[model samples]
Target: MRVSRGVPSVRFVTALATVWGRAWGGSVSFDDEFGLFVCSGMRGGFARGGTTVGGVFLTRRPPTRALLRHESVHADQWARYGIGFAVRYLWEELRNPGSRNRFEIEAGLADGGYRAERGITRPDEP
Candidate 1:
């Protein structure tokens, strides 16, 4: 869920998928077939497979609309670039943990405006 809009600069570092899911009343889980890895920490993230796949270390998550949108992007990346791309993303991040890249910015922007222009700030900044 979203925190106090009345307060700004209260930054917290978390996975983009988790934040988006929480905003829509859900949580994130890691599954070999289906898990979410933020772009900041890695190039590609995985989500667990379901139905079509059988017992082969499958990872899965609950069904949620927010998750679909957020995670689908990762799925696309994996498909386009294959697993090697993901590996490289992870490698680079492991070398430097301070990298907050494009995905972070995009996620923040998507979640940023809500109560502000809508006049939801409690007697706050303009």
Candidate 2:
């Protein structure tokens, strides 16, 4: 959808996500570089390594730089699509599981900790 900044719906969704992260009892802090509210130390209630909702990234522990970089792209996606992004993302996931998902590919599969197929390998791998 590529919504512009200052959109009320986007802001509302972002704020809601932030509150959701807080309700999980995670420590929240803003990362100015990626424009994300990093919420770590969550006990449970998320998927995979973590999940980004609007401007918030929720995880069990501090994320690596590469993982943050990958998740930053998801923050941008939420900004672009607003609340609708969730439905779109779920559809994509249903259609293309794991690293095959276009959104994950856009965010960098290796950075998100998904093994790449078709002979592609992460730079850190031997």
Cα miss at 35, model 2 (Å)? 1.4
- C-alpha local distance difference test of each model: 0.31, 0.78
> Candidate 1 on 1-126: residue-level lDDT in tens?
122111222112223334543444443444333333322221123332211111111124443444334344434334343434346446654663212323212223133221223323322224
Query: Best-fitting candidate, measured by TM-score?
Result: 2
User: In angstroms, what RMSD does candidate 2 have relative to the true structure?
Assistant: 4.3
Q: How many residue pairs clash in each candidate at the backbone level?
A: 9, 0
Q: Using alpha carbons, what is the TM-score of model 1? A: 0.31
Clashing pairs in 1: 31-59, 33-47, 33-48, 33-59, 34-47, 34-48, 35-46, 35-47, 48-59
Residue 12 of model 2, lDDT score: 77
